[model samples]
Target: MMFTISVPKPGLVRFSHDRTRCLQKFDRTNSVWSMKMEPKFSHNRKIEELSVELPAQPHPPHLESSRDRALQFNRGQPSDKDLDPDDVFEFGGYVAREAMCDEEYWTAAFLRAETHWEDRNRDRYVESHLRKYTDQEFNEIKKRRNVQFGNKCRCIVAMKKDSKDVKRPVLKSMVGTLDLRTRHLVGGETFPEERVKPSNFGSFRMTRSNRYGYIANLCVSKPARRQGVATNMLHFAIKQAKLDELERVYVHVERKNKTAQDLYKKMGFQMIERATPQLEEKQLYLLCLEI
Candidate 1:
C-alpha cells in the first residue's frame, strides 16, 4: 500500500497507515484522511514529524571590539583603539601603552600586585581606574614601558584615598607587592639578588630637582589593598630612580592620612626639611627616602 500526507503550516503531525487492503492519503491542511482497508486492519505504520524556523541576530560593535581587544592583549599584541596617553602615565609604570607587549612576561608578573591580598584591596580598583582601558590598551602600556626600560623597569600600582575601591591587601603595607627590577643597574657588576635592593629614596626629600622621579596614579586593585601595595609601589619607584642614579626619591602624602604617613615612616622615609611651592600650604608632606 502507498500513502501520502501534506501539511499547510509549520507544526507537528502524526500519520498512520494500514496495509490490510491498501493505504490512502492524509491531508492536514483540509483535515481529511482517506484509507482503504481489507481483511485485517492490525498491520499499520505510524510516523510523527515536527518543523520550525529560527530567527537571526546581529552583534554590536563595542562588544566585538572588546572581544578583539582581549584576544590581542592575551597574545601580547598591540590593539587598535583610541586612548588618552595620559592614562598610561597614571599607572606610573607604563610610559606608553606599547611597553607592556615587549615584556609581556614581566608585565604579567606585575599583574600579581592585584591578587587578593586583603578583603578591601581585592574589590576596589578593578572596577574603577583599572577598568578604564580595554585589555588592548593595558597591554600596550605594559609593552611600551618594558621596551623603554630595556626590560629592566620595575613597576607597581597604588590607590588614592578618594578612590571608589578601598579594600585590604595581602602585602599588608604596599611595601610587599613592588616589582623591583635591577636590569638598569645590571651593567655595574650586579648580581640578581643585589640588584633587587638599591639604596635610594631613604634620604631625598621632594624637591624641584627630584620632581621628575615621581610618577602619578600608582594604584592597587580592591583585592590587594592594605597589604602594602602603596608602600611597595613607593619602594619600586625609589628603586627605579636609584637605578637611574638619582640622588633620592620623594613622594607626597596627603596630610590627613596618618596610615600612609606611618607606613612611609616605617619604610625609612622622613618628612621634608622644607616644603616648597604648594606642598606646605596644601598640607602635603614631602617624604624623602634615601636609597
Candidate 2:
C-alpha cells in the first residue's frame, strides 16, 4: 500500500503568498517541477539543481471536498493566491483554514488541550486552565510558536453534525483537529529570526539540513475515530507545507502513542535520532518526511 512520487527538486519550490495555490507547478507533460537557486549573493540565476523522488501517501478514504462554497477562510492568514469566491472548495468536516473568530478559535485550542489530555486527568485540566485563555496568553503562545501576531495561524477542524430532536444537521462538536506552522513571513520579508527550522523536541537536531514545515496539535475526538478525519488533516498540513515550497516535513509524537507513529511511518516519515534532554522531552518521538 506504499508508493512514491516524483516532485520538482526541493530547489524549485517557492512559498507562495497563498496557501491554496498549487504546491509546485508541475509540467504535466513531464510531471516534474524544477527550480534552481543562484548563490545567496548572486544576481545571476545560476546555481545547483536537483529533481527529487519523494515518498507519498494517498489521501484518506473519508476525506472529501466541496467546490460549491465560496472561498472563506480565517482572515489575515497567509496564502499565495487570492481565493475567488466563484471557485472555492474545502476539505474534511467544516475545515477552517484559519479560524478567526475568538469563540471558535478558543474552542479549537480547548479541543487540542483536551484531546492531548485524553481523559487522562478526567476533565480536571479542561476545567482548570484550558477552558479559557486571555488575549495576552494567546499572543504569547503565538510568539513562542513563531506564528504571526494578528495573523491567524493555519488550522483545520472537523466538525460533527448534530441536531436536538430534529434531523437538520447543526454542527455540534469539533471532533478532529490539526495545526500547521509555516515559516514566518511579513510584507514579503522574512520575520526576524523566526524560521520554522529543524531541531524541535529535546534539541536533537537533524544531522543534515532541511527546510520544512512543522506539524503539531493533531487530535481526533473519541467518537470521530476511524472515519478518516486524522488522515485528512495530515493531508491538509503537508499540502500546505509543499505549497510553501518546503523540502521536508516533521512532527513529534509521544513514544507511548504507537498508533500515531505507525500512521506517520505509513506516510513515509522515518524516525529521527534525537538529542538527549530532560525526561519529558525524551518521552517524545520525532518523525520526518522529505517532500
Candidate 3:
C-alpha cells in the first residue's frame, strides 16, 4: 500500500519508501513500531527519550530606551535641520562653498548637475536660466542655510575625540532649512527673486499660516543623488518646524517630480492646492504636516 500526504501553500516535506517491498514487507515494517514480540528490551531506548526532551530556545536580548537618557548619552546623529550651513559647505569642498557665494553660479551648477538626475524639467529651461553667482551672494545663501539650521535645532554634530583632525562630512548637498520667526524677526526684507510664475513647469509657493514661520531654500548638491538625502533634509525641516511650536509646516512641490510627490505622500503630506490663473499650466501643491 502507498500513503499520500498533501500540504498547503508555501511549505515542503520529505518521506522515504521502498518501492520493491511487497505488501507483506510493508505490513511487517508498519508493525515494528507497535510490536511487543520481544520479552526483554536490552537495547538502549535513550534516543527516543532524548528526542522528546529537546532543549528550549533562548530568549532574545532586550533593548533599552535612550530617549529618557541625558543628551550627553544620546546616540543620535544630527539631521540636516540640525547641522549648520557652514558645516555643509565645510564638508562639500571648494565648489560647494563657491556655489553658496554666487546664485547664478550655484544655479548654473545646480542646473548642470540636475540634468543627470531625475528632474521633472528635463530640457525645458534654456541654458540662459543657469545664472552666474557672485561670492557675496554665495556667502548670503550660506549664512541663510546656517541661520535656518540653528532655528530648526533638530540635531547638532558632536565632535569625536579621535577624529578631531578629520573634516566634518557634509550631511547633504541639498538641505532644506527652516527658520522660526517666533522668537526674533529676520532683518532686511527682500522680494523673492524667482517668484512662482505661470508656466508649464510646476512651482511651489508659500502656504498661508496663521502662526509665524519661514521656509528656507531647498539646497541640493551634485554628488548626492538618489540617496534619500533630500527626503532626510525635508524630515529634519519638519522636525524643526514642530519643535518651534508651529501650527503647520508646508512645502511647494514641482508638478513634474512624481518621485518626490510619492515620498511626500509616504511622509503624510497631501496636496492642498491646484493651479490658479496666476500659476498657469504649472500646478502648485501646498503640502502640509501638522506639528
Task: Please report the candidate that would top TM-score against the real structure.
Answer: 2
The stretch of ten residues in a row with the least summed lDDT in candidate 1 is 47-56
Worst 10 residues of 3 by lDDT: 45-54
Residue-level lDDT of model 3, residues 15-43, one tens digit each, is 22622111110111111111122333221
What are the lDDT scores of the predictions, listed in order?
0.35, 0.43, 0.32
Candidate 1 stretches with Cα past 4 Å from truth are 1-99, 102-154, 157-212, 280-283
Candidate 1: global Cα-lDDT? 0.35
- TM value for model 1: 0.36
- Which pairs clash (backbone N, Cα, C closer than 3 Å) in model 2? 8-33, 12-35, 17-79, 17-80, 18-79, 18-80, 18-81, 19-79, 19-80, 204-275
**Could you list the CA RMSD of all candidates, in the order they appear?**
33.6, 15.0, 32.0
Per-residue accuracy of model 2 over 45-91 as CA lDDT, tens digit each: 11111111111111111212342122222223223243332222254
Cα displacement (angstroms), candidate 2, residue 167, comes to 10
The estimated TM-scores of all candidates read 0.36, 0.51, 0.37
